[model samples]
Target: MGPTRKRDLAAAVVAAAVLGYLLVRATYRYFPPITVWTGMSLLGVAIGLAGWGFYVRARIRDAEIGVGRGRLHPLAVARSVLIAKASAWMGAVVLGWWLAVSAYVLPRRGTLRVAAADSPGAMIAGLCALALVVAALWLQHCCRSPDDAPPDADPAPG
Candidate 1:
């Protein structure tokens, strides 16, 4: 793989690690009841899905390069980046919705009095997840195939 592809793969690995750490830390810190477990589980699943998406995209890009397709157009690059972002956002929303629902239901269970008290760690974890998504997006934007030669400025030799 080229340097750009290597960088993207590295970024994906780092993002996954960060997201995992945040999820585990937040889950224990918050110590939510059974209902909140659903939200935590969703968050974990979202992180995993987003990470896999990043890996798949990176691998595809690498394969395209190996097959000699040359570099992708800027628009294609942008589209790939957008797709990764959308996937991450979808995951985040699923997790966030679960968290919201759990918060609403938890109060009725008479265990917690305020959402704010338990949300700091969860919010930090959410932010970490967002950061991971952004990292994947940035990596997609930066990748380029080595086969993409510079544009010609001179006329062709006879």
Candidate 2:
């Protein structure tokens, strides 16, 4: 499969944002208060992904430099790519949802006590989702093989 495209992720975010905004506008009244734990959970996932990225980068770099100690496994790289792609998409969707929730609540904060209470939590969660997306992208980049051509480059003539 090809690399995850930024454009695709952007489109997913936009779609999710619109849907989340509508959902919140209609049903936020029934929902419980958002907690900081949501952000903390996402942050934890992002940190794990970042750590994996570092390990993969080192393995790829060492293999490219002909280090026997860094013998990379093809299956591991494949699994990493899949995980990174899924995480990126998941992060974008969550980021959009949290951002929409924040946007909706922030404006109502002064008039609604519940909105005021939820605003900061939503913002924090949104930031963590953004971090997840960044970490996933980094992992995806690390999985690219040294022989792979730039996404924008044309193939060489035979």
Candidate 3:
């Protein structure tokens, strides 16, 4: 891999690690009394890790084919996008199902004691988690190297 590609990959790893930590902390704060929240957080972590795994796998393939020495190839970009889309879809479906189930289960079990749905802390934490997922998806789609540009493009005049 070239210096630039190596740098980009390293930066991505660092950013993901930091974001993952923040997401975990926010999840803990949002659902302090529920084990379900921990499960959700773990799911998020797994999704993130899966995405990263895809990324590294793509990178390795690119390197093997001499594509990594240049900019990211279209195939690598496509792989990352697919992984991100899968992760986002999975997270959304699982989270939605959990929320729906909790709505009924909690009330039926007489465990809905907290009456602060409108509480600022809870709202903020929820929003932060949502934002984290959105950001992860965006990052997965947006961070491709310049070499991954579409073919049949005209070179700009110098």
Per-prediction TM-score to the true structure, in the order listed: 0.32, 0.94, 0.38
lDDT of 1 by residue, 1-158 (tens): 22224344445545544565466446644555333233354345446545654554565576766754444556765555665555555444433533443344335435544444445545544455455445544454444343554334345656
Off by over 4 Å in 3: 1-70, 108-132, 143-158
Clashes of each: 0, 0, 0
- Against the unseen true structure, what C-alpha lDDT does each candidate score? 0.48, 0.92, 0.47
RMSD values for the candidates in order, in angstroms, are 12.0, 1.8, 12.7
Query: Cα lDDT for residue 128, model 2?
Result: 97
TM-score winner between 1 and 3, please give it.
Answer: 3
Query: Which residue window of length 10 is worst by lDDT in model 3?
Result: 1-10
Candidate 3 lDDT tens digits, 65-154: 787654456676666666555555544444433343333333434433442332333333333344444544554645455355534456
Candidate 3: TM-score? 0.38
C-alpha positional error of residue 39 in candidate 3 after TM-score superposition, expressed in Å: 1.8
Q: Rank the candidates by TM-score, best first.
A: 2, 3, 1
